[model samples]
Target: MGAPGTARRGPVGEAEYPPLSRRSGWSEGSFSEMKYYEQGTSAERWERARTFFDAKRYSMAADILGGLVEEVPDQVGPRLLLARAYYHSAQLKRAEDQLRVLVERDPAEHYARLMLGRTLQRQGRDAEAEPHLRLASALAGDFAAL
Candidate 1:
């Protein structure tokens, strides 16, 4: 016997049932999060992220790009955008982490080196940033800046 008020059918066998609640992971408050960021195809999400970035909503762009970067770690574009979003949002540690990965994956990537150096510099780690900055300058063939 179920709990008194939990039965689907009424006591008199008149087939009465309560209306079902939504069986989704999302609630009303999270609907926009799901709709704009989580529930789209890769292309749609990428476009959404770009839109957010263009709107200067860096954190929202980062949230979407973070997932895209994770899904295709080998792809440089999403990771670069994710890192840029982090940098613009003043998420220095996260920007540094993503830039480091990008640099490690492609050491000759001048942009990633430049970004990593800048990220480190923003964190007040000049000593750690020097080598990267020099390398980025060398890679870009602007040795006068080095």
Candidate 2:
């Protein structure tokens, strides 16, 4: 028998493993086959980006999200997330550019319209923003009182 604190080795000379570290929750070789972006790519990237942003790692999050958006340009969610990252980082111009693309691609996307309206309003383009806000409100059934 092995010592109480030591693991017994098998015939192949592999020892029993200890518990995983609490800090990273990952073991060596365990994550070797995992891709950061696959299957739930956008959502996983978004979560990581948000974590970075929340931790005040704006530049890191922005860099990661920028790559994600570039790799998945057709995905509106990632684009919107990238725009939000830019907006949070005070890169309003880039945010506006991303949102503009979103509007062009999906005219009826209410959230995109609302965000675009907000961005326009921030830029003092009230006239341009009004229609977008109106469109968003209309689509969301919030325009009845407007």
Candidate 3:
């Protein structure tokens, strides 16, 4: 077998949902074909995205979750999962964008603030990360006192 994340479309995923073959007539090229995620009902897609995320297929999860987040902008759960998937996939900018939007929508969301701070830090923007990190810590402390 290959490395941990390399065997992404291996037994579990491949066996369950075989990759769309060229004969099926998708106009997408090879690169897009490889990136194509399985389509299903909303709940099924959510479960698939979660399963992919759990399996460490970060890019696959992110791809699915990104669309889900767009579909349900008011819902924080899918967005958070998308951010996490982006983060793990080394898509720091996208993760930061998602976290920033979450923090803006709900400034009291400590985890989002923390993640925003961390994402910024990961991108080497330490100066910007400081305030968010401090705010996150203060928020945690306040919650602890309650």
Q: For this target, which candidate reaches the highest TM-score against the unseen true structure?
A: 1
Tens-digit lDDT string for candidate 2 (40-138)? 556687788778878877766777778788887898877887777787777878889999999999899989888888888888889988998999999
Which candidate has the top score in lDDT? 1
Q: TM-scores of all models?
A: 0.76, 0.65, 0.71
lDDT of each residue in 10-86, candidate 3, tens digit only: 56655433344456543335445644464665677789899999999999998898878877889998899999999
TM accuracy, model 2? 0.65
Better of 1 and 2 by TM-score: 1
User: Stretches of candidate 2 above 4 Å error?
Assistant: 1-44, 54-57
Off by over 4 Å in 1: 1-35
- Provide the clash count, candidate 1: 0
Off by over 4 Å in 3: 1-36, 142-146
